[model samples]
Every structure is written in C-alpha cells, then in structure tokens.
Target chain A: MTGGARRADPKPMDVDALIDDPGTKIVVCCGAGGVGKTTTAAALALRAAERGRRTVVITVDPARRLAQSMGLEELDNTPRPVPLPRPVTAGGGSRDGQAARVSGDGQDGQDGQGSLHAMMLDMKRTFDEVVREHADPERARQILANPFYQTLSTSFSGTQEYMAMEKLGQLRQSGEWDLIVVDTPPSRSALDFLDAPKRLGRFLDGRLIRFLGPAGSGTFRLLGAGMNMVGSVVGKIVGTRFLNDLRSFVAAFDTVFGGFQERAERTYRLLRAPGTAFVVVAVPDSDAMREASFFVKRLAEDAMPLAGLVVNRTHPLPTGPGADLSAEWASTAADTLADTHPLAVAALRSHAERVRRRERELWLLERMTSTHPDTRVTEVAARPEDVHDLVGLREIGSALAGDER
Target chain B: MTGKGGTGKTTAATALALALATGGGRVLLMEVEGRQGVASLLGSAPLPYEERVMLSAPGGGSVSVLAADAEAALLEYLEMFYGMRRAGQALTKLGAVDFATTIAPGLRDVLLTGKATEAVRRREGGRRSPGGPHQYDAVVMDAPPTGRIGRFLNVNSEVAGLARMGPIHEHAERAMSVIRSDQARVHFVTLLEEMPAQETRDGIAEVEALGLRPGAVLVNMVGPRLLEGVELTAAAIGELDEVALIDGLRVVGATDPTGLAADLAGEVRSYALRHLLELRVRGELEDVGRPLVELPRLEGGMDRAALTGLARRLSEQGVRK
Candidate 1:
C-alpha cells in the first residue's frame, strides 16, 4: 500500500479556485474516449455558472445523457440557455464573486445570477456556417453542393477538430459568455482540437490541392511533364469526374477562405493565451492515463496553458473509521469467517477488492505524477451510480473542487 | 467488432481472435483505427501494416495482427489493383494520399474495408489468384467505434456517389460484399452502462439497416455482484440488517467491528444501487435480441494472461470458435 509513496506529494489542483478566477475565460477538457471529458466539462461549466461567471459549454460529441443533464434534448448547433437550477445559497457558492463582477466586461448583467448555455457541435452545420460567414452566397452554395465538400464537411477525420476550433473562435469573438468550456472530441483526436485546424489549413493549401485544382493553374504549369503523368495516373484511378469535382471544390474553397491557415493560427494562439486553461481528464486505467500523459506533453510542447490533470473514476480508499483496515487483515478475517459469517466474509472480501483497486489506482497515478512532476492533479472518487443529471453533475463538481466526503 | 470508445472493443476483438484461434485455427486480428491497440494489448511492439503472428495460443493456434492504416491500404490498393506503385509515390509526394485518406475519409474507409475484406478473400496459393485454401480461418477486425461503424462498414454506398466508375468504386463494392455477406459478423462490445448499452443497441440497428450481420453483444467489465435476490433489493433500498452485519463482523474476530460493519454496509448499499442499474441495463441489452456474453471485470487492467483468460471465458460462454 505504501509503494506509491513519494518523497513529496504532488500539488493538489485547486479546481474551485481555477473556475472562480475571472481571468480564466476558457476551460478545455480533453481526454481519450469514455474518460468523462464531457461530464467534466459540463460540471466545470455548471460550477462556473453557479459561481457567478456566465458560462457556455460546447460538447463536440455528447452522449444523450449529457445532453439531457444540460437540459438539451437534441443537438441544435447554437447555444441554448440551460436553466440553471437556482443556486442553493443566496449569494452563490464561489469564493470571490467580486472579481467576477469586476471583470464582467459590460456583457448582459444577469444581476450576479450566473447563466449557463449549452450547445452540441453540429460539425457539418458549423462548417457550412463558416463557409456562409466567409464566402459569398454563390460560392458557399457551390462549395456546399460539391460532393467532395459534402463528404469533407461531414465524414472527414479532422473536420470535427477544425469545426470545434472554428466554433470556439466564433464563441470567443462573440464575447457573450465570461467562461467558455469546450468538451473536445474523444481519443487522440482530442489533441487534434489543437492540431486539426492547422492540419486542415495545410491540407487545404498543400501541393495536392494545387495539383488537383485545375488544368491551367499557375502551380500546375510549374510542375510541367511529371505533373501530367501523375495527373493521368490519378485520373485513371479516381475517375475524371471525381478529380473534376475535387478541383472545383478546392478552387471554390480557396477563393472563399483565402487564408484559412491564418485563421487556424489565430485559434491556435488563442488556445495558448493566458485566459485559456487545458485540463486533461483520465481514468485510473493505463490506456487513459497514457493518453492523458500524451495530451499533457502535447499541450506543454505547444505552449498551451495547461491547468492540471483530472483523474476521474478513481477508487479512493473508502471513508469511515475502518478505512485504515489493511487488505491482508480483511481477507484473513474473511477466510476465518467463511463458515460462520457468510455476510461478513462477503463484506471483507469486497473490502479487500476495494483496497486492491485503490492501491492499483494510486500506483497508476503515482506513475503519472512521477513522470509529469510539475503537473497538478485532482482525483474524483468513483461514484456508485452513473452521473446523468444536474444533481450528478454537481456531485462531480464538488468532487472536482476537492470537497472530501 | 465495434463498441463505444473505451468499452474494451479492442480487448474483446483480441480475445475473440484468440477464441476463434482455439483449435489450430489461424486468426487475423486486425485494427483499422491505427491505435495499435492490439499491439499494446498483446504487450508487443507496435504492429506494422503487414500481418504477422503476434501471439500463439494453445493447441497450436496462432493470432496474427495487422494495424492497418488508410494510407498504406490505399497505396497497396493502387499497387495491387492498378500496378501504379510510382503513381502512388507521386500521390504521397503531392499529399493526395493524405487528401484521399484524411480529408476525404470515405475513400479512406473504402480502402480500409477493402484491405480487411481483401484479407478475407486472399487465398494461400497466390496473390493474384482467387481460388485456393483460405489464408486464415477467421479475420477479426477491431473496427471504428459504434458511432461511425455503420458508415465505416458501408463503404460501397458511401463511395458509390463519389467514385462512380473507378477501381476505388469496384474495390468498395468488393468490400461491401464481404461485409454484407453471411461470412461477416459485426460483434458489438459494450459495458453494462447506460451510454455504452444505448450505443450498442443503436449500433446494432444501424448495422442491420446497412444490411450487415449483427453478432454477439459482449458485455465487458461487468463488476462483481456482492448481494443477490431479496438481499440485493433490500440493500439497494438501504434496508440491510445492520445488527446481523455487525454480529457477523464480531464473530469473524474483527477489530472495531461496529465501524467496519458500517463501512461494509455503505459499500454494500452502493454496490446494490449499481447492481440494480446494471441489471436494468442488462435487461435492455438482452432486449437488443443478440447473444449477450458477459465478461467479468478484470481488475488492475488488462494483460496478456487476462486477455487469454477472457478468450477462454468467451469459449465457455458458447462463442463460436
């Protein structure tokens, strides 16, 4: 049990303090799949809102339960007001409400009653909105109509990441919410939340688009004979019409969004801004922790402002006076009681199992802290039931804020 | 195999491969997501695009793994189908490979499904020839998660509108046949959680709508049930007999028996609540009408031994080898 003990314990992450800070305009929760990134982001948003900072949360791919918890029945692409169940306390629960009021930036005065708005990212619709906002109606229609754009808008791998950033940019520029919490797409693609915009930009402006653009584009002319041979081979493989549609789509997209790279770069810089904080969420398992470590390092490499790591669903040692009971003792007692006390045997066995799980979780978290010593971490104890409502979200919020049971 | 993310889809696929490989059967465990999850689960180095024996089960059976990516599959497709290796290189240089695989992922899916189905169709005698002894007894694909599996496996329909008359189109058609044929079984891996179970049900519906065969619904990471029947219900409602619990702990020669009993009672109550939820979810999953195979939760995460243990469990649960 003491195997995970370190020379000095890692710093505990101050989740309440982080959310309560007015300077923290954006909190992006990113992690691998099924690590409760959406739930964390939602809980943080709800916490931020109840703490008197108007917040909006954007979930890239929310399960129905999350949407329902936020009072959203369907994904409607735009932010809809989530009726904040009235704060239990009169003056709100935040430590420093004065700072939030001082930093209110002349937005809608909710009279210190913080508001929360929730939205699910409709990736294709968001892409269409970008086109509509940037391009003229005709070019937008043309790009929208193109079969290649249709597929790229909806089915492409990095499009979700790109659209997420694009939507984030739109939300930030709107300046309607004091805090914006973003639930990124799951898995390695969550890191794409940072890289996807640039990748999409690079892809859009890459030589392939130039080669496939049009027959007489200036860049194509520069390639000369080798280009023709390659073009013919590609033509033979993908069919001439497919290439033609791609060319037209690329040409139109280029004309519409002339400097997507620059916009992507802007969003990238925005993420690195002091106002933003990246929280990498993970469960106690090795796979999720590895991904979380990768995400932490990725954020560090990119100079992004990382707040901390949230280890969700951790099996902490059970509370009560008997918490000090050793696993070995419990198992031994269970074995001795096997004949006489079936219930005691079952209870002691379960206690041993829980103790073993806690040890394993601690070991995994210790490995992470040892590797990323500078990273702050907060552990959310495993809830017995699934979190699917506002009350559940509040419980998670309390756990996140280090409120010990 | 498909399931919600982190539903042990990869682990289930590996175990299923091991199960199918049980009797000297050669099984190809392929992952298209490029996570190299199979490699990691096998505790081996990351697998390359080529299929190689990653693990050997008992009875002389073996599991070969392939971490198939779209770019490699497309390059291979171009080379094998059109003899345009140099042209494929050109595409790579020009980033058309990236475009085809990443920017337009339908084509990527087409190539990926094409590669998997190509493995399914490949004969032992030669690369070009169609008829011979089967190369592998069974091919298990760790496919995309439930959310995207319908579109991932429905390659031909997605490509039909894009590549109307090319080798890509023809390749997608071939893959679709293998996918839609009786040979394929799209197994779904899910936990007894609301979201995963919901996704499994919906995923089955989507796959069935795409005309793919829905196989077993594997419930992974099912937790231990401490109490059952009337006691389980009583515990769930916070009505556990505390005096009996404390007496039992005292009889076991426990120190601070009262405190320990209270702690254990709390644990039991929570477990009962969770068990009830799991039972509801289990009922819903059973209503999905597929064979539901439940795998117990493997504590301390998965390793090679636990994976093989899961394979044995699958066999015991009547999963066909």
Candidate 2:
C-alpha cells in the first residue's frame, strides 16, 4: 500500500512543440500489439496536418481501419489525401487546443495551408513492386511465379516488417510530404521492427540458403557431393518436385538478394537519422509498462532519436471529496456508509475499484519514471466513446498534448 | 483458443482448462509464446518446455501446464530424426530450423500443431507420481492471435512450399487432418470492442474457408451495466437529477458529492454507450452461429481468485461440455 502511493508528477512531453517544430520530419509510433500504436500514429498525423504541415500517415494494419475512421471509403499503397475539417492556414491555435505557434519557418516548401494523407501497406504488392523494379522482366516473372516465392511473399514471418521499411523508404524518397508518420506492425517486441530487416537479410543470404540451392547453380555449393546425396534422400522423402520448386525459387531470387540487403540497411539508417522521432505508446499497466520500458532501453541502445512516451487510456480517479481527500479515504468512508446507503454503496464500491486500479497504474508509472527519469512522457485519459473520426482524433491529439480532458 | 492481442487468450485458455479439469478429468494447459503469461496468471513459477502439474480443481482433478519453446521443440524434432550432433550444429548456425518453425509461418504452424496433437494423444503410465498425471484427457492450446492464426494453421498453403506426396508432406497432411477433424476445436477469446469483434468474424470466416473447426466465442471483460433500463435512459438523456445522486452520496459518509455526482453521471453515460456497443458486437458474434459466452469484467484484477471465478463461469456457461 505504501509503495503504491502517488508521487509528484513527472515531466510531461511537449508533443505540440515536437510536432510544430519545423525541423522534425518523421514521427514513428512503435509498441506491442493492441497498445494503440495505430491509433496514436493516426492522431499524431492528424494533429500535424492540422497544424499546417504537409503530413502523411502510414499504417501497417490491413483493415483499412484508419481510412474508415477518417471517413474515407478506402486507402491503398498510395497516399490519398484525407480531407481536413478546415484548411489549415498559418493560423495560431488551429483546431481544438492544439499548439498555437505554427512556426513561421515553412517546412513544406509550400504555402502554410496544411494537408494530410494516409495509406495502408499492401505488403505483397510492395514486395511485387520491389521485384518488378529491381529484377529484369524474365527473372522477375520467374521469381514471382515460383511457389516458394509466392508463399514467402505472403506468409513469411518478417514480410510485414520488411515491407513496412521498404514502403517507408519509398515514401521518404518521393518527397511528396513534409512530415511522415508511420504506424509500425503490432509485434510482441518493439525491437522486432528494428531487427526484422537484418534477420531477413541474413536468412536470405545465409550459408544454408546457398547450400540449399541447386548444387550446380553457383559458388554456394561448398558441401559438394555429400550435400546432393543428402538432398536426394530428403528429396525422396519430400519428393523431387518440392525440392525442384525450392531450388528454382532460390536460384531465381539470388540475383535480387543484394538489392534487398542494401535497401534494408538504408532503411535502418533512415530510422536512426536525425529529424526522425520514435514515440513509444503504452497503457498504464504492468504488461504495457514493461514493454514500454524495454522499448525505451532499446531505442537508447540503438541510438534512435526518441521523442517521448504517450501513455494511453489512463484513468484519472474521479475527483470529488476535496483535492486533498485521497481516493483511499473516500473508499474507506464509502465502506463505512455501505449499510445505510445501498446505492451509494454501489457507487462507492465502484469508486473503490477505480482507486485500486489507479494505484496499480501509479505504481507502474512510478517504476517507469524511476527507470527513465529523463524521458518525456504524456498521457491520454480513457475516452468513453471509441475514436473514429477527425474530430475524435483531435481530442486524442489534445489529450496527448497534456490537455487531459 | 486465440483472439487479438490483449483479448485474454491466455486467460480464456487457462480458465477453459481449469473448467474441464473440474470433472475429475486431467487437462493440459499449454502456452507456446513463452510469455509466461499462464504461469503469472496462475501465480505459479515460470513454466519451461517440460510439463508439470500447476494446480488441482475442487473436483479432485488436476491441470498441468507447459510452455513450449520453439528451439527446444525443434531440437526434439531433430532428435526423432537423424540425432546427429553435426547436423544440429549446422542447422542452428543457419537458423534453418527457426526459419521453418518460427520465421516461416507455414512450418511453424505445422510444428506447433504437431506437438499439441501429440500431447492430446499421449498415453500415460497407470502409476502416478508427485508430478501428477502424465496423460491428459484434453489439451487446450493458447494459440497465436487472429492476425497470424490463419497463416499459422493454414497447412494447405504451406504444403505447396515443398514436394507433395512424400512422408514430410504426409506429416503436414496428418496435422491438417487433425485440425480439420471433429477432434480439434479452435475457439476465439475476444472483447466486445469493434476491432476484436471484427477480427473474430474474419478469423472464423477464414477458419470456415479452410474447412477447419471453429468453436465458441468467449467475450471476456464485459463490463456490467449497473443502472437499470429507465435509470440508464434518464442518465443518457441528462434527465437524471444530479441533485438526486448527490443526495444519495450525502447519505453516505461522503459530505462532498459534486465531483462524485459528476463522476457518477459520467460513468452512467459511458455505461450506456458501452451497452449499445455490446449489443452490436453481440449480434455479430451470434451471427457466427457458434456458442457465445460473456464473462463479466473482473474488478479484482487477474489474480488467482479471479482465475477461479472465470473457470467457474466457464463451467456454468457449458464451455467444458
């Protein structure tokens, strides 16, 4: 009980200042699955666009969920303009309680009228594009048609992460928008987004792949006759057709493997570059906080520029019974009055549950603060209604900017 | 059972296992993610790949838990095959094994399904020891989330990755056979939220498309609607006299009711909104034509007592039957 007591509030993250600044170009929201990473990225993008910056948000969720929320029929691999409530001029305090200062310095190299665009990653389509662009006509067709290639493009574990990076790099190189917001895939570990490219790169060019390719294809066959004999025996078990499909797939893809590796490394560098910001989103619970803490440490270790943390769905205990009248005391008093006031009893019981939940949230918060000390943090209160539109996103953006209401 | 992340897959799977074990039948609770979520939920030590009995039900039945790691499972698979030390070295270096099991979703499902089915069919010696029963009458798997479940269980898709009509292909075919058979069931543990509900719908559709068995949908963490119909309507329409709630609060030890009244009103409003949302989700879930079970939100948090409470609910809800 003593350990869970509230402490002085930690420093709040200045999200408006971060987004409003002319220097910032990219904001990446990364977190564990179901932690509101997609929602956070969308809200941040909407906020940025409304603040008069040409901004584009990309989400890896295939549901076209963001598009539906923004009132658009659908969105694809290409960025489609999301209609804003108002044309954002060089006005101060535009939309909700957003940051008033829209930085006189023009980052978009256009008029101060802000624009927002959104797109959902079509991973296989993106991979197909990469192949079509990198490989020649004949080789690309062969690689794309291979049974193993089709499966790898579709169901391979890291394909989403790899395609996300590819798309991010492509979006940046296009120079269409001043700011880009990326919603990472809902991986169990935030670090998976960072390690995926490398893991896949290694897997693609590993010695095993080389050995697995047809023995007479290239220099990769170091195991010599012994390997072919083993392959033949396994071939008999799995059948020669399966072996031939895998070999042909590998042989055809061997040409474009270098392009994949180079692009992966390029994206890795882009993530760590200056002007790119990583925002870790989490809910104020033990599981969420633990994942957030790991994200903070990982970004630090990898030297990626982290903007701050956005703690979502926080419940501020109902504020009655005087500011000094702690939730604990109110709960105790409610317990004492349970016999006389039955309805009050129910309300108080609910209050007690809220108090207990708040204490646990605070405990997790305190641990996070103690561990990171210097990391900027902001929180969004739990909203009663689900957010699905520009208006709702603005409220969330306001909340992220420390409005709290 | 599995749903979206944070949909309480572990909780539902554990409770289902507990519910089944309540009838003097042995049950196996397994988690393949290695998150130790099952162990933490049961208030027990972290589970290794090896099986161990975690707790016993009031009905004199026991539930054992296992947390299987991919590396260990792959090694076990390899041991059954060549049993070559050099082969293990070469495979581990290239991570070809992990690739086939983890990175490659197709083969990963094959391995996971194979191991789980094995547990389901294992026969234990008649003699009982301190570790509890070696055999289980039933096995419950905490499966991958909806996003991956389709690929993870889609054996037909992965079978095309290699040559067909061989023993390896037959092995995968056998796993798929079990999945599609009446013996195996895939249930969904979801919340009333739109995302979860929609995902559940899509997942069930996918399962049906692949001709796999889709079981009941358990809606976990359904918050209670405290106020009655008229009270809720009054609250929603802002006709509920705040002064009345204030008076009710004042009758208690609380002298101040302004903040409390506002909070109370807000809670009522949210409750009304949530009630409607649940109705919509309920219709969608029912449309799936499978059994639907609604588990009340546990105010006491996910502790051992709460686990037992949910298990009891499962039993009453006819999930174990």
Off by over 4 Å in 2: A1-5, A62-65, A71-75, A89-109, A216-221, A229-239, A320-346, B42-46, B82-86, B125-134, B161-163
Which CAPRI level is candidate 2?
acceptable
lDDT of 2: 0.74
Q: How many steric overlaps are in each model, in order? A: 0, 3
Task: Name the runs in model 1 displaced over 4 angstroms.
Answer: A1-8, A87-107, B127-130
lDDT of model 1 at residue B29?
89
Against the reference, the lDDT scores of all candidates come to 0.83, 0.74
Q: Top TM-score: which candidate number?
A: 1
Which whole-number lDDT from 0 to 100 does residue B90 have in model 1? 84
Candidate 1 global CA lDDT score: 0.83
* TM-score, structure 2 vs. true: 0.90
RMSD of each: 3.7, 4.7
* Prediction 1 TM-score vs. true: 0.95
Q: Report per-candidate DockQ.
A: 0.65, 0.46
After superposing all C-alphas onto the true structure, candidate 2 shows an RMSD in angstroms of 4.7
Per-residue lDDT for B49-123 in model 1, tens only? 899998887788999999999899888878887788998998898888887887676788898888888888878
